[model samples]
Target: MVSFQQESDGDPASKPWYELGSAKHQGTEVTMARILQEQYPSHSLVLAHDVLYTTYTRFSILSMPGVEVELVSKPDLVVNNSFKALPRSAFVGTPGGDNVSAELVPSVEYGGFKLTWKDRHFLLYIVHFARGLSTNTQFFLLHDGPEEPSHQLLLAAGSYQNELHDEIWQFVDGFWQKSSGLWKDIQSANWDDIILESDFKAAVKKDVYGFFESRDMYKRFKIPWRRGIIMHGPPGNGKTISVKAIMKDCSVMGYTPLYVKTFKNFRGDEYAIQAIFDKARDTAPSVIVLEDLDSHITEQNRSYFLNQIDGIGGNNGILVLGTTNHFERLDPALSTRPSRFDRKFLFDDPDRPSRRLYVKYWQDQLAGSEDISFPEALAEEIADSTGKFSFAYLKEVFVSSLVSLLKEREEGHDVSFARCVREEIATLRKQLDKPQGPEVARNSQLAMVH
Candidate 1:
């Protein structure tokens, strides 16, 4: 029988069970290991416990090949018949409209089940121990054969998790989680939707496409195959949209896109950095998107981040694409370093031609709408008048003007859509004259795109 060994000088069996206060019991309760031994005397037990920085889950382990797991009809004597219900929300997009659906997923919180692998039967119990403020989950596998084979089985289960093709892996809260919603959200982002200089757009695409396609070229030259590119510019430019378009294309090209939301977690930032690179190495030929890279890297973690990017362990076949609104905030080691972030693309304010193209994009959108009139010549006029305005501000001018026009139409007042747009642009230009802080600017940018 497997037992929980106490580190201190105390009898483990004499200790009270953590959940004893939940019920009224006269006698002292025994451990689950003792109960398992008394209930199944013929089976040998193998215990797998969670360690620091490592965790094992039933779904992840059971997802291994040739392992068939089924819920037992009857609950074990030691474990209770309780299940945890978690709420899951999903967006269903269709041709008609978008609908959000919510459902509860009932999972076994404390349960025992049977599994068959290679014609051998085994009993498994999932146990959760409440320690002060946190919970630790452990697995108990009972089999008839020797302990070595059972240990090997557990090792195999812990070593591998099925690769996800339909979902993108995101590192958040110190864990690599599957984000199917992000993958779905990027599907609509295409290169054609981006408004930028033709040569600049082609350069961005060629750099990304060339790195992934030229592995043999790097081998012949005897150079490292990894590359890092940074997109730096003012807020509300095309940095984010460009990144999304590239991510969508990379997904189509069969390279996994791993997005890092943050590097701060319960564990130190250094640990998070290590875990991030480890996952990236495991999924080589992958693209890592670090949006707001300036905020993610600080003086404390800059050295460690650089080491991981071009460290001795080698970052082969991994492309690191980072975006930042404030390029000056980045350290020289990161921005100026050759191998760390080899190339930098400046996404400054859109030129007159790009702004005109953006206005034309809106014209095409409103071509079918009879309520709004956006003529061909107004595109050039709007672009000319909207000087020094970021894409976010331009978008706000359009959206706010449309809203004002709708209100005027509802009040039985005839208003010209083009005049409303020109007035809104003038009003926004006044706001731009006043000195704005970073937080205010960030909020304005987020409102336009998100």
Candidate 2:
């Protein structure tokens, strides 16, 4: 609603049209003024909230490309130019009155961004200063009642001249620039990347080649090409190491591996969570690694998660992969469909062949120049003797042996292979026999295996 008050100069009822008090409205009167402006063809200017005056003037000039912005801070200043002409004394300050209250027109106040325009149809680019996700620029069409205007009208809006702060704009702009760059980084990442351990090299070649063949067949048959894999095992197994090695191998083939630790709060915030899916959609052919899956996204949360994933709508290009120590804890609904996690493989504790290879792997990594070389025969013996030792424990054994060998060499004595092997074996034996209580041991032995 627009409220109009009558005003008169001392000259009778108003001498002439130029000297008469023109139609004036308050800050909240713009929407109504816009409506009136659309109906009438004679109104030259439509005034809005005083906060938008500066923005309107600046934007109106810049959006035209070849126009210049002229500031008339005081209300009585006249403006004239070759390209655009605004009244030099157009901007009006309060006409003070003895009976009028002091609160009427002292100053302008604003909380959000302010903008303005010259013509009935003018563009506004507002920069709302904020604290969070840093949305710097906004382009909006502030039309007069969403229709064609019957006349031209000057629409002025902006904050007070002295209150124009550049620091806030700079902060918003800086954050916007940095935040936008993450999209470019995400776009540059590759999907289809997998890494395999040196021992699994042959199996990986056959597995991946066959994996691609199945994928091709799915596409040929117009099937949803999604695959899930379950890599489950005891703690300290090669599950993590195998994933890392696979990442390294996949990097060679231009796969960009993104590791997501699926804890309680995987998504940062609502916007950030949406952004992850947005980036996924934008940057397809990528691998998303959900690590440590059991702690979060299980049971009840899993259903909620499936709902969210379905809502994402365009996720076919992403290759979903995951790792977990407790596979049974995962929701059965995840693997209910055959192709969901089509390739489930166990990364059990090292068997004999794996143990022998792991021993060589670590020995080659830590052995000194004059140190006793890795004994394949000894490794075979250790592999045969230590049935419960995992690859991680073997790596620890190799490190301990190297330290022992270095100490013996410092003592100026020939290191004995038997002594080193004995020390490593003793450590392994202790780890193997470290007692859980009788009850816990019994439960561990009978724990359900999935």
Judging by lDDT against the true structure, name the best candidate.
1
Top candidate (TM-score): 1
lDDT of 1 by residue, 1-450 (tens): 333222253322112333542555532213566666665677788877655343325234556788887754342324435343323453555587855354333334455666777677777766565554565666778786667767777877766543564677888878777777788888888888777777778888898999999999999999999999999888887888888888888888887788999998888899888988887788888899999999999889988888899855778989999999998898888888778888888887666676887888788878899888787778778988887788888889889998999999999999999999989998998988834323222211112110
Candidate 2 lDDT over 369-410, as tens digits, reads 554665667767766665667666766676777788778878
RMSD to true structure for each model, in Å: 8.5, 17.5
Q: Single out the weakest 10-residue window by summed lDDT for candidate 1.
A: 441-450
User: lDDT, candidate 1, residue 204?
Assistant: 85
RMSD of 2: 17.5
Supply every candidate's count of residue pairs whose N, Cα or C atoms clash at under 3 angstroms: 0, 21
> TM-score per candidate, in order?
0.77, 0.50
